[model samples]
Target: MAAVGYTSGDPRKVNDTGDTLTGGLVLSGGGSNLTVGGSGAVTGDLSVAGRLSAAGVALPTTFPGRRAPFRDPTRIVTHFQTGHGWATSGGVDAPTTNLNDTTDFAKGTQAAKVVFTGNGNLDISGLSSIDLTGKAIRFQVKVDDASKLSQLNIRVGTSTTNNFQWQTLASTATSKLYRSGEWTTVTVGWADVHGGAGTFSLDANRVPSATTGFTFIRFQVVATGGNCTVHFQSVEVIDNVSATFPNGVVSLVFDDSWDSQYALARPKMDQYSYRGTNYQIVERVGQAGRLTLPQLRTLQDQSGWEIAGHAYTTAIHDSRLTAFTARQVDDELRNLRAWLVANGFHGDSYAYPGGQFESTTDGASIEQIVSRYFSSGRTVLSGYGASTNVLSEQYPPPRPYRILALSGISDASGGQGLVSSLVAAGGELDTCKRLGSWLILTFHVLTTGSTGGDDGVITQANFNTLIDAINSYGIPVKTVADVMRYYT
Candidate 1:
């Protein structure tokens, strides 16, 4: 059956301004085939006919070509090759959406992108899906603007929970963009986003009450100042069934403090010789001590204490802005950097102090206050292997630092001993499915007190036991710095 509707001209209803027209039609139980030809006009504007839409055009079965279905141009991954060129500020060049341009990133580009204004969304209507798997939505973007960057945002919602406005899977989510201005590619795939009712619907009639599906892809300018321009060139959405992690990424983190511990590991420990009644150890605790030329030589000869910084506080986590003042943050960063330099260690990655990056979840922008100051950072968040949302301007996940956390030895409150307590307390091995990410873990002297003596410092036996347990659990133990290179 071929049902077509059309209109030519007539005394159509016009608005007061005469700039627009209105019309309506209702079709009930129609004939086997009805052809309402040349009769479609709205607001009296029938000067031209744009397209001919059929009521239904059933196909034989299969078709191909699954590039893009709908586009509003809000996200960089959805720019989809606009003929009009785009530009960026900060004297930086806009990133290319072409797959050939790879850089600061090693994971490879999944989408060609350009930034766009998030507040005013790119208007799209009467859109259709090409794949129809209704599994997930997939797309990528890149934003590396240093001078100016908005909170990369994306939101899609409906009028009511059940009474929807749009019938797409992308219905709700508030997102932000990074201001780094350096093209950061992004990918959004809803194939993993699950829902019920057998098939997904984006019509205003179907709304999800207790399910997961999107209605829209609303990209946003994350920072402030009202507007932004993003460039997006291509898009490819696949089902959740095919998602895979990036290639060859290990556990997150490679802290520099190990160097100091290693320094303390060799010659220093060799100096203490067992005499008649006691070991002749001669390094004062707490207070700095002047090393006599003879003692220094003897110690050096006995053990090799490599020239390294004390590594004062490699940061348990990134600066939690909600946890510190500007001065405090500056001081902490300065102290860490100066200590690293003084100790001959090239300051690269800083473990987030308190296992965090910003102070408060809603305080001064993380990128504005922190990322700009540091080269890279690592965090304790879990990983999906491929998409680790760590310390990123677009999607800053919980504990976003360097990599996705896979497991941990100690609990946050520092409780150790007893299998029941440890189990009840639960180690940090993630149970949920991550999208392929490098997991990072943190550790300190596991004791009930402080790090000064036989009281707080973890006993060598306990340390070995913990290491063995982590190994048994199949979680890898790594320092903080190593993971930063993978994501940031």
Candidate 2:
């Protein structure tokens, strides 16, 4: 039987299973069996009971039953065996005879030891097909004399034509990656590898040897002062999962130890599974319209509320603090510290009264005094925790002591009368979610009176709204001490 179809704008003839076709043809029929004597292409899925053969046929863009590209969590590229595929050049001595040393092993029993007569290097080839974007390279190294080497250089590329080089010192400027006379695991982010200064310049597209995949990685030790021995082991390429922060962090800080905080806010916060820090003014602990010492202790012991220091009196306000002498500032801080300690409240967080401190005028002297008594201090500004921000930004050494900044839930006059303030606080919470920062909110009185009163008071209804809004974000409410512990 003949099958009918057209090819190249011309009609052609095809025969049944046993017959041969001399020209290109398309087969269509109700029967199950059809055969082609020449090359053929099928666009739809095909099923066959017997084997199908396609010689000199181009592979499809994607083949069925093909596994995903291989990715090992710790893909060890080399263990430095003698006559291993690795190539060495440039004043590098041959592999050391003593390969196994318990004192200097990072992974296997053997390692590659290279002594630099001058400047020496080693090149790892044959890895040109792997995708290395967002990957990190790690290796363990021990230096006989760190002072002899100026910097360790790392270069990665697609073959040798295109590459980027980075030095250990570049990362050391921002991170603590290098330690002298010790086994240090050096992990280099692939993104940090760039072509400039010590690296090879790339094309305009910034593609590092795009023609071939990244196959060449080189480790070079440049000699500066003298000769040194370096041991290398467990060279690996790891999938880089960059460090990240939680969704957000919220801290509810109530200042002045107001009676409403103990009577009104505490119940609502407890109902929502939340807690806050109350900066108690030592002098106003037991008077009217303030939390009593027993109430403060109850909040601390039972409710998990932090009773932090907020100075001895209102005389420490910003405007007033500018007039107070250094002795006066010392007296207020000392007395508050003594009171909190004596009351069995061993909390190490302090808040500036009215968000005011002598540091505004006396500079480091006032901050020095506050630091002497507390682990951390709080200000009425908006920022993340000090250590967290510094570590996230990868700031240089000698991190500064972070003074927690507060984003007030109340209006400029320190009252929560306006509904807009609540909306704005929600926006601040969203910002924290995006930046993974902390949002410290300040509130005073939670009474049922005028919402925007001058005494820094808000209605209990608005206080619950703010608390619910914070809850909706699902951010953890942490006390000042908890936050300090998190970063520490």
Candidate 3:
């Protein structure tokens, strides 16, 4: 039978076996499969239904497979104890043999063992050539009796006369402690070790210049109470970098049971699948112009919003709790908790009413009460200066409780303006993305009509726009409870 070439316009039929397609070929029929016997190029996206096989084919070396090599800018400049390049000073005695075979060594087979006798000290050097500029030094050590060792210090500088010293027993956030009979890692940042005087006089912000990089690095151990033996190993200089955030988080908190939030703002948030927190004053529930129990419960169950405790009465904010007696503050918190429990709410968080609190007088008492009841408590922008303000800074290390600083969306005179608020919100979001930090933005009322002079009311349109902006940034929105869980 002769092969027939149909030239009809019907796509069901291949017009000619020898014909070339100028534009492209489209296979639209159901369950139709096309096979290419030779190499082919797809300039656009190619959708595949079944498995793609390229066995025995010579593929391009740059073809996408695993991700390309990514070397983190933060890394170790030098590593020691792998071989010999060590020296010791003072009356201290160095280990006679390699201690790598012993289980006491943290890493590698070789370690520096210093024996402290009476009031004498040991100074270990030889890392003078390696650059310690803007880098932190870390080493592992095991002590026979940590109590007997009076002090352990590290000195780094361009020269002996230009040295800056840091004491390990200072108990700063970066300080490390040595445990008795067990290996403990000690990390000291260069910024923390700067003594602010000497020939080097390294500033906290300045790194060592190329020409005058640190030429001396020493570890000194002083035995005050008694003599002890210490094993040190795995000395390294590492760059200090901010911790990476797993997707960058933003937590939305609505203070006070403002009626506009339940009516105007929540629906817009629901449209985008975002959840916020409502810090409710139990006394305001079922009031004439505030969020009722039904509304709060609906937000909690349907909208996936968190309902946390505020204060019992509208007259007292968290900061003003200092004015009230200790008994009064305790009563209000207890009542708020009871009200939440009776109303079928499981709140594990609290927010300061006005972000004001007296830390000296009743602050400790209030914190103690909050700690006993809730997992976390939040406060408004307490610190005034930009440097001291928590919201303006990057997310700090995790703590059991955080005085979450907030940036108000309202104007300085206390009026809700979309343009300024959006600018402020975007800046906060950018900071969070840059530092991989957690940002908590506080919102109050969402209203179309103003409450006369109320500064907290945000229009629905502006609210939606703000939410869209946050969504465009690809930042994950979390509730107060979620943040507490993550940080704690």
Give the best candidate by TM-score: 3
Per-residue lDDT of candidate 3, residues 355-450 (tens digit)? 533332543446555554566667664221222123221233122333444545543343223334433533445434533445677788666753
Clashes of each: 118, 0, 2
Candidate 3: segments with Cα more than 4 A from true spot: 1-244, 359-364, 382-399, 411-426, 449-454
- Candidate lDDT values, in order: 0.30, 0.57, 0.55
Better of 2 and 3 by TM-score: 3
Arranged by TM-score with the best first, the candidates are 3, 2, 1
For candidate 2, what is the TM-score?
Answer: 0.46
Q: How accurate is candidate 2 locally (lDDT)?
A: 0.57
TM-score versus the correct structure, for each prediction: 0.34, 0.46, 0.49
lDDT of 1 by residue, 1-488 (tens): 12222233333323243322233332322222223333432333332122223454222111111111222222232434433132222322235323233333323343233333333233222234233222233334444442245334333332122211211111111112222433433333221122223243422211233223333333334333323444443443433211222221223222222222223322223333200000011121122332233333333343322211112332323323345555445444455455434433333444443334434444444333344334444443322211211211111122223323322333233332222232221222221112222323333333432322322233334433434444445443322332332231
- In model 2, where do residues sit more than 4 Å from their true spots? 1-245, 317-319, 358-364, 383-404, 411-426, 453-455
> Residue 310: error of model 1 in Å?
12
lDDT per residue, candidate 2, 204-284, as tens digits? 322333322567778887766656677777676664422223555667888887888989899989987687888877777
Q: Which scores higher on lDDT, 2 or 3?
A: 2
